[model samples]
Target: MANSLLKHPDFMRLWSAQIGSAFGSRITRTVLPIIAILLIDADPNEIAILSALSFAPGLIVAFFAGGFIDRNQKRPLLIVTDLVRAALIFSIPLAAFFGSITMMQLYIVAALVGAATALFQIADNAYLPRLVEKDQLVEANSKLESTDAVAEAAGPGIAGLLVSLVTAPVAMMVDGFTYLWSALMLTRIKKQEPEKQARDENDNLLSDAIAGLKACTNHPVVGPILAAETLLAFFGGTYLTLYMIVGLRTIGLDPFTLGVIISLGGVGGFLGAMAAAPMAQKLGLRTTLLITLALGQLSNFFIPLAAAMPEFGAAFLALQQIAGDIFMTIFVIQALSLRQRVMDENLLARANATFQLTTGIAVTISALLAGPLTIIFGIAPVLWGAAIGSMLALPIMWLAKEEKAA
Candidate 1:
């Protein structure tokens, strides 16, 4: 199975581009906030706003973007979005070099880049069905997710080094280059995407978007997955903010150490993605998802404990990250494969957009809450709370009867 998946051309091309892009995203993820907090001297609230802005566009634009993507080809959208992102990222360094960088400007740029990212993702998900045979969907997704895991592991460490040597704004230039590389690779892919026919002149955009949402809400599998994913996103986002504070300020770990720990988690993610197909084959998708979801939730509790106990804290934290990454990769692959298998081709973009919207909203809410929650409950309590909230998703999954299908 692995050998055949590796040999697939479309999968290879998509995987290569995704790996490059994921690395670039991780670089920005590490350096961007650091630049805001350390260089620009932004406050915690401002940082929260920055994070929220980055994700908010996705929540707002996903439905419209989905409709547009459905009316167009995926490959071109991917290429255009990549190119636009590359340009936007390049502007960051340029502004910094000229002594014109500001927090507001950075916020705007992050929002724009995020919106473009949403468009790219909607198209990319829609494009996958055209790339490989139906049976290969799970395996192909696993390979792509594994590449993402590798990038997640390596990108932050590389970003830390670059920032240490060249400064944060300068480090962003590397991410810009990565986007360009991704765009170049995308340009080389020869697949012909099916174009959407023109709609009636009287067609209503709002109605179409609403119809898409209804389809997702009404679907048996997609609805539950979205609910679980939204809950996961909300908790995960809060955890991320708290984790950073605990790792950096409370524990006295430097950025490099944090990067290494994150990378270690990536190793687990890669292993998880690689193992996903076999696990699905053995346990079946529903059982695999249930097991992984539970594991992911349980691992969250360990993070706060690790923060409290400095002795062996890093190791415990690393283990938590690895476990979380593994579960995330498995869940993502399974969810995506099921969506592709079940949804109509024409509704693919819209359905995916609906999912993206929920995730974005959850992330935005979590980002907004992270600051106050940490202040009130402290980082440890917040992490523990997130773990508890995550576990609640299990009952939803169980009640949905996802395993019956498998």
Candidate 2:
């Protein structure tokens, strides 16, 4: 039976914090690349590099972050990271106001914000188990995902208006304030977290990091999920690296249209979150996961097709967004719930970290290659290749039938 988290005040606060952050984050995601493409006139190479910087910090620091999170208090880490992200994001608008903005400054901010995001993600994942009962993981995650979907649905439209009324750089002010709001909500949570486990005198950060990797790899259930996620990340990264560029520059989508299309995906995401538990209950976890993962990859075919046909681009993109987000959101919620359910609490942070590190490496590599690949093969062919490559994960999922063998 699903435990009711409605009476849990701390969980509510966390949920509240997340709602603001998710909305603000969607705004930032919408404006950041638009700022680069429109205001900075960044080329494909620069855009690829920017995307790479966003994922590289997770690749570089995730192992250590996982270990550190395992040994320390997550609440403080979450608070600090929020504050840092707020400050870093605020810099963009500040620079814009001073007429000192440059690609180099944007690059620096992306790298720093990415680092803070990596830490915040690891800490937040680890902190959740402490906030609610194990049985409530799905419900808790579902609520969070739903909030994200709503933000996803509305944030871009709002961002589009902001970008139209003000400039993209100035529009980032909303994200900064949202982060501040998230931090304040986090501070009000009065739940006492579990005491940190005693660290061995001989155990260092590296060793702890290694142990976390071992925990994931050694676990029968988590090992395959990790492998599948890493593979998907590479293809997903390649396609996403060019998505905005193609939408705005190549396909000639206006900011408002682009935002509306992206928001449609959030609507699908909300539906997916609501449907996940029921689907799992009906079709079984293994079946639901395999089907959703495959469908998500297959949905990408629309993206390249949309790019190829400019007149029908919006319709194709919208179909892909709604269908793709539904399946992917279902896959993500189930996968995360499974991980939280099976992993030992002491190693959960590290395991989550290990997943992030590996996937981050894959995404970073694919993103770095996207620009060069586009130059060599053109964006359409490269996008089609990414979509096909993502299907390679299906076999991995099929083989991971140890969850229930149903």
Candidate 3:
């Protein structure tokens, strides 16, 4: 089965691009914050805004990007977005070298990258179904997910080393090269299918977007999935911010130790993605999702407790990170596979857009509140609070009958 999956040419091409992009993204995800904090000397509030700006464009561009992607060729969209992001990110190092880099420039670059990323995401999800057979979907997604897991595990450590060696801004240049590499790989792939002509007949982008929104809102499975994902994002976002703060400030772990802890989760994610197919076959999708969801929520409690207890905090944090990553990998692979299987190809991009938009909104809100909430309630309280919020999603999952279809 693995051999067959690995042999599929289109999947291989897509997987390569995804791996390259994932590596690049991890560099930014780690180095960008470090730059803001260490280089720019940003306050907590400014850091929060930086995070929010990075995600905010998805909320604004997702629906429109979906509509646009649905009407166009996926390959070109992916290539163009990757190229644009590459150019934008490459400018960071250039501006820094010239001693002209500003916080405003950073914000603008992040936001613009986010916008281009929105289009790429929509196009990528929509393009997947066309690239592989339906039965191979899970396997293909697993391979991609596994690559992401590997990237997550390796990218930050590399970024940390690179930043230590050559500063944060210079480290970003590595990601710029990765994006260019991804774009080149994408361009080399031959997509025989022509672009969809559906939007050419329609003159009104607004009307089309609204209709796409309605479709997602009306879909029984997709709507609930979006709701659950939103809840997860809300809690997960806050938990992430708190996790970093707690680890660095409260627990007093050094950067290297923190990186290792984060990397451990990526190892778990890789294992989880590798195990997803068997687990799904054993537990069924519905059972697996519910179990993982519960486990995911339970996992967050460890973070706060880890923060409060110094002696065993590192171990607890590592365990929590692993559990969360495993749950997330399983949840994403199954949920996305189910979505792709059920939704019409024509509407897939819009459905994915809706999910992305919900996540973006939830993350934005969480980023905004996380700083203030941490200050008011402390990082431990914020962590526990987000854990509680995650549990709220279980009822939504139950009420929506997510188990029935599976």
- If scored against the real structure, what TM-score would every candidate get? 0.89, 0.87, 0.90
Candidate 3: regions farther than 4 A off:
33-48, 97-99, 166-170, 200-205, 374-378, 399-406
Cα-based lDDT at residue 294, candidate 2: 88
Report the number of the highest-TM-score candidate. 3
Compared with the true structure, all predictions reach lDDT values of 0.81, 0.85, 0.81
What's the lDDT for residue 207 in model 2? 88
Model 2 clash number: 0
**TM-score (C-alpha) between model 1 and the true structure:** 0.89
Predicted candidate 1 versus true structure: per-residue lDDT over 305-369, tens digit per residue:
87778676777788888888888778788878888878887888888888888787787689679
**Cα deviation in Å at residue 183, candidate 1?**
1.7
Q: Clashing residue pairs, candidate 3?
A: none
Show where candidate 2 strays beyond 4 Å.
1-3, 30-52, 91-105, 163-170, 245-255, 307-312, 374-380, 402-406
In model 1, what are the clashing residue pairs, if there are any? none
Q: What C-alpha lDDT does candidate 1 achieve relative to the native structure?
A: 0.81
